[model samples]
Target: MTGSPTHEPWEVYALKYTRNDKPRRMDVMLGEGGSTDPMPMDYFIWVLCRGSRTVLVDLGFHAQVAARRNRVLLRTPLEALATMDLHPANIDDIVITHLHFDHAGGIDQFPDTPIHLQASEMAFATGACMAMPAIGGFYEEDDVKELVRKLFRGQLTLHEGDDVLEPGLSVHWIGGHTGGTQVIRVWTRRGWLVLASDASHYFVNVLQRRPFMWTYNVGDHLLGFERLLALADSTDHLIPGHDPLVMEQYPPPCADLQGIVARLDADPLFSVHDRIPVQAGR
Candidate 1:
């Protein structure tokens, strides 16, 4: 799971930190009309490990925030990382896909680490758009204020567009769910994988061309689907942000971690589209 300059294929882990037991199908697939089927949601924070380097994507929300929002807080993001032997001190940097509470709430846990974010996202979270409760409700004031503090403390790295964190890891701005939402692209053993954090909340969102329920700009969100496909090595390489199916599709790093964390660098056990078992390396 470690990488060097030449060995750029990093090991990516999707750590599930929170869960929503009963998200209506209609709520998740808003553009495709609505359905009464039950579709649960899982919140995640990703970990990318290389030689002496570890990058985290999207810090999970705090326990209190989860309780306030009525989400099932499985565990803290730090606790999830500890299962993989990663700690706040070991995180080199963090890539915040957006400033939503679920994604940016844990910034305070790593006060000294440099957090990378999209410039537009920062502006959007702090701009006039936030004055509207509907738009601002997704973002937590504490998280935004913490980010502002990070800016003043010189621990934030704001990127205007697509930016590289290193040789194999990068972030691309693709606004849809929020003003400056972005996705993470990483070179993995399976090839390029797009961590579609909120860009596509579920595989069906992109695979079926349906936008998620919450969005800042529908056009950008729709375009982001194509962008994600292009960024990934293949359709299966694109991982959705909140789909519980991710746990079912991809195998865990080990037997003990089943349903808790998924090893993204490995081939999935089932096809995301059909949910059928697939041969290895398919």
Candidate 2:
């Protein structure tokens, strides 16, 4: 949304893979008003497609991981992609938003495809900070090891900072939830659309400038919200990584795809901001 694009815009899709229905508000936001009420969360992997080129965002975790984490595995990432006629072979590249298990657990699924990641993220996941259970608990050892294997196999692409993967598609580093969290920006028909993976887990996180409970650097996490706003066409154009509101705000590609895949390139059914609660004393 910041600049005019030289190439045709991409069509973005958010595919739901898993969910947690019992998560509490305290699990999502950090503040006095946070509640114990169910603050449901959804897991998703985004796709950016144009013509024959397809760019896959984070890979959703497998069912085994899902069961261990107590998340309801609706479908595997591979099955979700199949709905759109996409396969690993069809993906031009895979972008690992960060190395969290939910986002990088399936790295082995597409062993031959190139992976895009921020260098700092890899270091953070493997660095000494992981010795602390609170910090390392979110990452899976196998997933991290697979990434290191990718690096050695010459299948990984690490960006030092913001960089374009292709014309009209780029990645911007915005670490908050993790040391290497990055968001994907794609030129779309509506304007620049931001795929905010964990930078802001829910609309409330960004709309209210509240950090999620699991943050590596609270200050940077809050800063990521501002950066997301600057990159998106509007709040409606920014897609929260794990919000169920995404499935509701943006309609599916067709009637059959409802609740499973949302067409992010199209206008939302209504303004997404309207759905965010107006906190007391605001």
Candidate 3:
């Protein structure tokens, strides 16, 4: 049976493993205090494309690391992928937004996949800041070790600047959240989807035109936000790195237990023009 070329859609799923201890005060990140409820850290793992070339964006936190660090894992990362009938081996390429433990810890789970990371991220993680007691706590030794091993083995693809991975997909180097943070832009049925992974942690971060402070250069953070917002056709087309409201807006998974996986080939039910009501300011 001769069928059309197998062009699969890009599917993004929220692999939420845990919530933050205190609802992260939205205003602190937005430079405004209008938001009341402390926002939960709803982590995610975005799966893109299909067939023999599946790309994964951010590999949620590892359960063991969370426990060892005395942090909570509301859900296991592996179990979250299982919801989509996927295993680590199923992934072909992994795009890491930054070297943060929450987003990079799961690389060990997918040993064979080639990882795409910005070159500067490696430098920042192992550089002078690591010695500082305040921010040192955020770096995961094991995760860095594994990534180093992969780098030496030539399993990691390090990009220095903006790069195109495919015809419809590209990576924009936005150094803010980290020295080498990046956001993924994909042309999907929903028009254009810009995964502002950590570039903008929450929707308000973009709306208020404020930036999170976990950055090397505050100026770069501001510029990155503007760059991402411009790349997006509209506000709705830009997906924040850790927004709880995302789960609420998108359709639930095919089954009730899983979050909806966005399909690149299918037209989005919603659009950037659609106005999502803003939560009342605190």
Candidate 4:
């Protein structure tokens, strides 16, 4: 979780998380599985550091939102930063991949940090999609209100399209999971890495061309894989949004941070032991 005082290119870590409730394969895919099957998932919010700048990719939901969904809130966004000796108010930037409640719910934590997001995402979150109860349920109004509050304070930076935040960190608009769902690309010690935020919830989603059931645009969802691949140093360089295998593939930054922090920029241990089992006969 430590960054360089020497101002080296950013090192990225995927702060670990998981639900406190039961799992369901039906929830993971679209029209493919029975609700009775088990589908384990992991959640992550990336932390990036370069010199004095520390960036958070997503601010996961808080206790209130967690309570509504019956999800286990293992740690708040502020707590995640505290692990790295960082205070929420000191975060240099916050890049929200989309406006989904799970990812954007913790906006109340870092009010002053510049929040980056694709304009399309914001538009859609408040647009016609709001009329659809099914689609609207993904967003918690309190989270959106917090963002609007920040926007009025001039703390929000909405990206019209792909843009660079700096030399080594950039965001690409990948409209699959959501219209404004963008992923982060960072230059690290290993090379370039792409953090696919719900762009590819599971590695199998990209490796096997399976899109998450709740995607907005099917084409964009599928193309996101190629775009992510293009930015990644290698196949392993691209991190899936909610795959437990991420922990196994990339070890924690330190022994003390085991299961709490994963150093993504570091070389991953290429072992089959990290791979999740793919069901037979697709």
Candidate 5:
């Protein structure tokens, strides 16, 4: 079977990974300039589709990632997957938004899964940037080395430009945060669902029309947000890569071994203000 027919509802699940402090601080810096707020970090494994093919957008942080960075594992990716009864091997396909350690670290855990990434990202990781200490801070050489091995093994698929993976499922090159960042757009029950993975890490990045600090090209970063907003039916439909508000907004996952995994079939309570404003610099 081709999984759900075009007319049938599509399902996407948000598998929790590490939900902790660093992201919370990032949100504070974006929203209140370091002022205290109740925001918390919520990371996830955006699982889409079902049946013969299962797609995951950005695997959450691995357990060892924290310890490697000399931090605590507030939320381990494997534990989060267990909540939904999903094993690493269950994932058929993965769309890696960028090669940042947090988003791409857990990939090796799924040995057989085919991974998709922009061609430019591959260049960035292999080029002089990896050797430059400044830019290297954003990436983990060990993790990327493993990804490179996967590519050689044909487990990684590199996309050059805008391309459709399936009907209603497409990948758009929107580099900014990194040299090869991209966003995934899917036709959902609530309309177009654009997964803004790292293109804009926080909702405030969109709300204030401000580019995050880690961008390689602020201009492209700003433009990427506009492009993503245009692709989304509304701002609420454009999910940020690391916003804590996302946890409260989307419906909880179905009951099972992985109940916390979000059920994409459920409609979100969208807000009119969630609509993306006109691109400020455009």
Candidate 6:
């Protein structure tokens, strides 16, 4: 569990949540001509462990926030972790994939755990871009305030560009969905795998060249997809941030917690549907 680049990959688990809500057509989530046949979306926060170091990715929105936003919250991310016997205190590092409310809401959950993120994201959250509704609409003011509080307490560890958190784990500043968005790359038993946080919320966002409408830079969003394809040992090794297929494709880590936790240390069971005719432009 020490570190791995080629062998002995870490255990990656996708703790998924059921977003029991209907999709609105023309919403930012839709692609240019995104299917009118109800878009399926789910929420998830990943957990990574290699021996002693346990890293949690993107703390999810709390129940109160869900209620306020009119979105269903089956279980808090912390509560979901409890089911797996992983308490918030046991998490060594908490990585903020982006500052969006859903991804960055649990600031208070992991007290004193050194947070990792791209520095530019902090700036985007606080800077004038927030004045623009199109850009700032996705973020909740309260979440940004809490992050600022953490910054003042000197509990946050910000990274610029790309950085290696440990021997086998690293983050790359992909900057697509958000100006400072980043994706996590880890060496797993399967090979090198990437948690494509918001870089590509769904597999189709990458494979079918469909872009999620709420992106900061369309060029960067498309580039992030290609980047994930290249960084991962294979296309099968890349995990999208919010795809429901993730749970259906990979078996749960244990029998009791079916569909709640997925093991990333093994090969994918389902074959990726290759409906898109064109190849990705590298």
Judged by lDDT relative to the true structure, which candidate is superior, 1 or 5? Answer: 1
Question: In candidate 5, where is summed lDDT lowest over 10 consecutive residues?
Answer: 23-32
Using all chains and alpha carbons, the TM-scores for the candidates as numbered come to: 0.93, 0.95, 0.86, 0.90, 0.85, 0.92
Question: 1-282 in candidate 1: lDDT tens per residue?
Answer: 223246558999999987887848655665555776777789999999888889999998898988898777888988999989889999999999998889998788898899999999999998998889899988999999999999999999999989888898888999989989989989888888899999989777888778887888988898888788888877788899999999988889999999899999999887775862322210
Name the lDDT value of residue 118 in candidate 1.
Answer: 95
Please, what are the lDDT tens digits per residue for candidate 4 over residues 25-92? Answer: 56567546567655677777889988877888898888777777888867876677778787886688
- What are the per-model C-alpha RMSD values against the true structure? 4.2, 2.0, 5.0, 4.2, 4.0, 2.7
Which has the higher lDDT value, candidate number 1 or candidate number 6? 1
How many steric overlaps are in each model, in order?
A: 1, 1, 4, 0, 2, 1
Among these predictions, the greatest lDDT belongs to: 2
User: Any idea how many clashes model 5 has?
Assistant: 2
lDDT tens digits by residue: candidate 2, 1-282: 487777888999999987888748545677746577778889999999999889999998877888898777878999999999989889989999998989997888897999999999999998998999899989999999899899999999999979988999889999989999999999999899999989989888888788788999998997788899999878887888888999999989999999999999998998965778633223
Could you tell me how far off, in angstroms, the CA of residue 204 lies in candidate 4 after the best superposition? 0.7
Model 3, which residues run further than 4 Å from truth?
1-9, 24-27, 33-36, 258-282
How are the candidates ranked when ordered by lDDT, highest leading?
Answer: 2, 1, 6, 4, 5, 3
Provide the overall lDDT of each model, using Cα atoms, as 2-decimal numbers. 0.87, 0.89, 0.73, 0.80, 0.74, 0.82
Question: Model 2 residue 64 lDDT?
Answer: 87
Cα shift from native, residue 78, model 5 (Å):
2.5
TM-score of the candidate numbered 5?
0.85
Clashes of 6: 1
lDDT of 5 at 268: 63
